[model samples]
Target: MIAIDSSAQPIQALRFEDDGATPNSRFPVLLYQLKLAPAHDNASAFESLFAAHQWTPLWRAGIFDYHHFHPNAHEVLGVARGQARIMLGGAAGQALTVKAGDVLVLPAGTGHRCISSSDEFLVVGAYPQGQEDYDTQRPETGAHQQALARIARVPHPEQDPVTGAHGALMRLWQ
Candidate 1:
């Protein structure tokens, strides 16, 4: 079943179409269990699942303390270990705690940061459509307008980063 936690007002989501944040696209939602079987902390598990969905692996690292986003492509973050509180949609965003078995499908240009986390807060990140290149754009960049345009041009992934095809991501994203 698709789990929707609206506890953060508009759920685990934030729209950045105002002020000086992202220009278009709604922030990602946290999925409690997108894939029940591959919900462990094994690197092979995450690599295999993302590969099956064709969402190429970009990095395997913990979230950074600084706020950032990708303006060239969307991303998927799987919590391979531990838990963390993330601030999404720039500084004025919602705070979400995600643990192992949880997945975050972030749209292009959605801001995110690791507010606080446990010692073993490992994450496996992937990009859509076998993409590998990305730019780390801060919300206060001078090229903010260009970033927004780039975000608008980014194509939506044909498959979900976790479940592919008709997964909850497809339903929520489209």
Candidate 2:
């Protein structure tokens, strides 16, 4: 189990490669997590620390896909279970693999996507609140795009009926 604590250590700014010779830069992202019982209210925890007006959870299973978010508000992701590979760029950088008990802080304007998942169910507590320009954009690609193209041709639940995207989630044995 790998644990990263941004509180103990100072938060550092991460850079991504840009189209030009110089790299693209942004604000520093601080990542951390907290443990609460099932009975514990996550919303209350967030409210105590920050003022927020909206909150939602983004869930996906199977193979990783591409998505981008230009956050108007700050977000805190609490890994509830399983494992996931989180990629944070349109360019190159280190992809973080997070497991249960891990916490990640995504500041405004950060673009990120999930790359993979483990055998167990994957769940995350997402709190979206407080701020101005949090926006998420997902470019169709890989299985997610393919599913959209072949939705009419494929006739199985595994083949995204709505989109026909293929990924590890479809292969899970019930």
Candidate 3:
């Protein structure tokens, strides 16, 4: 399946604040630069790996080119092919390039959008078991408060998409 680079440094953790327009999460986003096992170098492998960790793999596609957040659920995106420069958080956020074998774990209400990408870019996305049908929210002047309320109510996932119970998510989110 997926093999974490033990020799590599620890996962990159990024924090994005609520930028008035987009209600970002209180939790930091977890970025994992995975080293896929030789025989598991495809989209299916990512899906299988996520599923095994209780993150239900539900979609295979490119990221949206506009800023949006999931207010009701967390998300995990695994880069299966090609590469892309993406913006995390709202207009006042950071841009990151994600290539094959990279995994991004976004907490509920974390804004994200694809800035630019290679033609062959593809990602496999998943959510915690019961959150597969997550909502897509864009910046709306009046909806900010409502979004924040929902975000506050969203529960911490019991398992990390890449690691199970005692993983980084469980530790950091606590």
Candidate 4:
């Protein structure tokens, strides 16, 4: 069974400002340290959990090193193996280490990049079912205003990837 330890609450809500080029989010990023059941297949554990909450697990891979964000959709990243140092909220953002069982819920336009990782680093990336058609946006000279408009239009996910409809996202996002 995939169960989150109630004690391992989300770290904090991280909100990034629009740094000119990178149109970061108004909604804060949420990090949840999960305690999953022992399973042989790590990726499947995450995929199952997210799917149960109506979040579609679309990819299995390591995070990209280049800075990027999604303006048309929100995202969830579940750390399935090893560990990684990820930079969150663009060039001026913070770098945090994530290990197995860590889950990050990023709002639309929230910037992120992989700084470093262990050899076995892997993650299950997911998006809201109807909002899976996501676009990756890199910080460019004239794309800020357009990205901001799109980010504003991206709807808040109906449910949290880790928790279901009554998850923290429902409270924090509103």
Candidate with maximal lDDT: 3
Q: Model 4: per-residue lDDT, tens digit, 81-139? A: 88999999899888999998899999998899999999999999999988888999898
Reference-based TM-score, model 1: 0.82
Per-residue lDDT of 1-174 in model 1, one digit per residue for the tens?
222221222224435553476443664554544333444445556767777787988788899899888889888887777889988777777777888767777888888899999998888888877357988877765778888788888887888766568665667766
Residue range with the least summed lDDT across 10 consecutive positions in model 1:
2-11
Clashes of 3: 0
User: Arrange candidates by lDDT, highest first: which order?
Assistant: 3, 4, 1, 2
Structure candidate 4, residue pairs in collision? none
lDDT of 3: 0.88
Candidate RMSDs in Å, in order, are: 5.1, 15.3, 1.9, 1.6
Whole-model Cα lDDT of every candidate shown, in order: 0.71, 0.42, 0.88, 0.87
Each prediction's number of clashing residue pairs = 1, 13, 0, 0
lDDT of 2: 0.42
Which order, best to worst by TM-score? 4, 3, 1, 2
In model 4, which runs have C-alpha deviations exceeding 4 angstroms? 3-8
Candidate 3 C-alpha lDDT tens digits along 27-71: 999999887655455688888878878999999999999999999
Instruction: Evaluate residue 108 in candidate 4 and report its C-alpha lDDT on the 0 to 100 scale.
Output: 90
